[model samples]
Target: MEGYSEKQLGILLVAERLFADKGFHGTSVRDIAQEADVNIAMISYYFGSKDKLLEAVFRYRMTATKAFIQDLVDNDTMGPLEKIYSLIDRYVNKMLNEQNFQCIMNREQMNREQSPVKDLIWELKREMMGLMEPIVTRAQEEGTFYKDVDVVLLMSSLFGTIHQVVPAKSYIRSSPEFADMPDDEFVEYLKVRVSAHLKKMFKAILTHEF
Candidate 1:
């Protein structure tokens, strides 16, 4: 969002929504131009190409998140477990609040096409794993966490558990109990329920009783 101007941001936002709704290959540059009420030349001038624009979307969404997590991990005030919980909480909030981006990401992963955004996704994931490994290792060394824990497996457990809910909202909302609930309220429910569940799982994993 920082490097983009108002016009560029507007176009990128439209592209993100469209990309989420329709797969990247399905959404055309003309569609983005019409949706953003801009000419094709403007998009080309700003982002160079459709693939580049998608990359920009990834950069726009992920750069700040990576920086935030890095800061949280680097902070000396919070311990390893505190940082882990903070990371989990932040991730849940991101998935709920930024559903469009989440959808775009999920769709990209599901798509078998060679997308440039996939590289960014994998890079960020690797970076995240690298960032979390030290924290887990430190906790284990300090005897606060069990030795021989699989950091990647632990991360996947949290990621998989939270992500599985995004695609099931339709059936979940179709249920009688959730029928009357507003989307926002349901997402709030998700935040609370998921946060508690992950915390419990993380506690079990760290304590090595699982």
Candidate 2:
């Protein structure tokens, strides 16, 4: 988004929504072009092919995420536990706000077809994990968190919970409890609910109480 022109960014945004609504194989170049209101040649000129466009979509969403995590990791003012809480909040807000991109990510990961997009996702996960490890290590070293904490599972639990909840809004709203909330209200409610739940869950998992 930073480097791309207005037209290019517009196409990426359009393609991202289309890819999320329609599966990658189900969405064609013409579909993206039509939705983006550009000629197919523009897509070809900007991204080269459908596969590369898909890759660009992933990169577009993940680039900011990578930078944010890196900044959180490098930040010295926040304590380790505080950083973890902040991380949880950032992810919850991001997933809630960018539900379409998250949907694309979840769908592509489940897809069995091997592609560069899949590889890129894994690569990004690894890099983020690498950035996050130091926070865990810092906490454990300071006796603020337990030594036995599994970073992978900890992240999996955090992300898995968010992933489960974001896509289940319809099911959740069917219940009398959340049935009447407006869409904006529901999302804000989810952000608070999920963030608090995750922070508490992590505190228990990382602290000696467990």
Candidate 3:
């Protein structure tokens, strides 16, 4: 816990929380310095500026994504479909657990034109599509999905499916039919719903090879 300098960890902790609670422009170096109990000058000394700190945060987020994707790509224990499921599970779990972080990510993406982390955002997206491509290719050859589907289109649909979940969660939870369910039950219900979509998409792609 004490290994890395407090200032470094401080930068990450403060940046993510602020970036999630308030948009980038709404957060400032002074705020982060105060929250992290470090000098404002230290932040600049370590990260150059608030903008650089924000970019560092996006880079940190990508590290987690990269690790899981790399493991799935390299692991021989699980087949292609299982690897895909594992990937989806991690992605969905993060969203379900961190609604604020999810919201922040989407906001940053929408405002990428002004974001300090725009390059990292684009790279994260392109890397995600690249990760899916090989799995989809392998699945098609293995008769797991369709051969005629467009890879990019299919990837877009996957992103769309996951992204839509957050916006609809409030609506679904407040509805009379779903309101009675417990929180865990509600998430499980969603898991099944998304899994069904994944299966349906998998089947569709099987018929065509997206």
On lDDT, the candidate that comes out on top is 2
Give the lDDT ranking, best first.
2, 1, 3
| Alpha carbon lDDT of each predicted model | 0.87, 0.90, 0.76
Error of 3 at 77 (Å): 2.8
Q: In model 1, where do residues sit more than 4 Å from their true spots?
A: none
Candidate 2 per-residue lDDT, tens place, 165-208, comes to 98687787788987777889988988998999999899889985
Q: What tens-digit string does per-residue lDDT give for candidate 3 at 107-133?
A: 887883677777777888888778767
The better candidate by lDDT, 1 or 2, is 2
Best by TM-score: 2
Judged by lDDT against the true structure, how good is candidate 1?
0.87
Off by over 4 Å in 2: none
Q: Which ten residues in a row are the worst by lDDT in model 2?
A: 201-210
Candidate 2 local Cα displacement, residue 87, angstroms: 0.5
Pairs that clash in candidate 2: none
